[model samples]
Target: MKKIMVVLMVCLMVLNGCTKDNTQDYTKVSNQTYLLGTLVKVTVYGKDVSKEVFNGAFDIIKNIEATVSKNEDNSEVSQINKGQEISLSESTYKIIEKGLYYSQVSKGKFDITIAPLVNLWGIGTKNAKVPSHEEIQEAIKKINYKHITLDQKTNKIQIHQPIELDLGAIAKGYVADEVSAYLMEHNMGHAIINLGGNILTVGEKPDGSSWKIGIQNPFDARGTKLGVVTIGQKSVVTSGIYERYLEEGDKQYHHILDPFTGYPVENELASVSIISNLSIDGDGLSTVVFSMGLEEGFDFIEGLDEVDAIFVTKDKEVYLTSGADEIFMLTHEDFKKKQMKK
Candidate 1:
């Protein structure tokens, strides 16, 4: 799972900083809770709003988590992982369907069937360790997205192999989008949905300006910002090696595992942030681009429409896609923004 620890706080600080003059009469309703194995903060700015709106939004998140989370023993995913061919909710079915699409898009680099490799290393859990080469190779053999069988008509799923499925990379984004839509349906025009590192803005800020989102400095403390992105009604999601890892002596292993090698992906990138109309796209693309490394990832993102990316190298340099230059601003002098080759 991509757990963004400090970026959420930085975004809250940015939103709170806007009301210094007290001239904004827009009502701000905010609440925080622990969900999806991370902190989820939802805030809406509108006139005559009540906190009760959050209850519906949070319920949507809870329902998705219950349906898709592999950690939940009774989740539909878990049941399917256990060799049971089962019916899925329309939402869960769509999430898995999209996960498979990303798997194909990244050429299996960003696979939901990577749970076997993830469990073997257990980077974020106490069981984390460097598995034997033979063990890793065995796990790799089971990490094929092609083994998944989905029936579109009945919303049923079956696994043809002994593979575990983990939707940690993309589930939260789906939840964020669902909540955003729910809030909008209730007539809230402006809001910030921060599901750990996945950020989706409902509209602009209450004052008719873009919502300023702090991009986490992968090498620094969590709340420390390397830059801020000004966006309206878009989602910002980042995947990085610094957040979750396992260390052995002088060697450190990050949570992002390469399915082919059954090891952490080695690259020039420390993190990749994607901005898009839907949080799920940002979520999946962030991981996909990170795995592609800097140059190829930059070119790939540049070729895509409605998607822009920020590639931060381990050396502390920043590279932005064509459209990113308009909204992303460097806030730290320590990080140098580089110009991408045309």
Candidate 2:
């Protein structure tokens, strides 16, 4: 199995605040488990919080994993990849639907059907390798989003081609969103759902303030912060070349592959962070924008509504969208914030 190392791009800072005596008795309950290829942690602070809440949240993740995980032998995606028609679960159907939307948004640059290329490289497994030019070309030919056939009425999916579907890019965020919804439904408002660094804040801090999130320093070790972003009830997700890669001799290949060339994307960006109301959007857009490089990605983000981005270049310069400055604060001297030229 290929496991994604904890890409701690956005780390949770000290979540402390002073609450007014009249409304400040919220208790904190948190638990961590290994699920969906990474460490999943769910923390909730609210009156009457219980272990059952965490259990239910994690259970939802497990259920979703079984339905959408491409690595699982009998998952819906796996079945579809094998060209076996199957009735999909609601979660699987919606994730595939949204994945197709992102595919279109990136003009097929961030394709979920790039599973053929993903397996060809195997960057995160013991079989990790650099495939031959011919192999890469073959894999690229199989990566087309149009092969996926989703029957909304029957909740079934069919793929006539030999393409495989990998949901790694967006599944984590969708799981986080579902968990967040579950928390809110159970009256747990203030919570932090971190699925291996895909951070989703449920509500304001117990003290009625925004949560402080540290943006990871791409060139530094895990937990190192280049800056901090303060927000309330939003999803913050980051994608970078440092997240996963395979090193061979003096050369290293990152996990973000380009469907066109069937190789790791070559760009000036070290990382891209997307902040949005939905974790699913953040998850997909981070990868989509990262592949677009700094300039194009910045322009794309500016055109989108209710979305903000933080782009950190390999040269240690940071660029932010218009709305980003309101929530983000640069704290590292090594990383200087630069204004994107209009």
Q: Flag regions of model 2 displaced more than 4 Å.
A: 1-24
TM-score of each: 0.94, 0.94
Please give the CA lDDT of all the candidate structures: 0.83, 0.85
Q: Roughly what TM-score does model 1 have, to 2 decimal places?
A: 0.94
Candidate 2 TM-score versus the reference:
0.94
Residue 257 miss distance in model 1 (angstroms): 0.8
Q: How far is candidate 1 from the true structure (C-alpha RMSD, Å)?
A: 2.3
How well is each residue in 1-342 modelled by candidate 1, as lDDT tens digits?
A: 454212222221243423644246777778889998778888877777776888888899999999998889999989978888899998899889888999998999899988888888877677878899999999888888999988988888877877788998888888888998899899987888888778889987766777788898888776888898888789998888887778888987887788888889999999898999998889889888999999989998988999999999998999999899888899999899998665
Deviation in Å, model 1, residue 124 alpha carbon: 1.5
lDDT of 2: 0.85
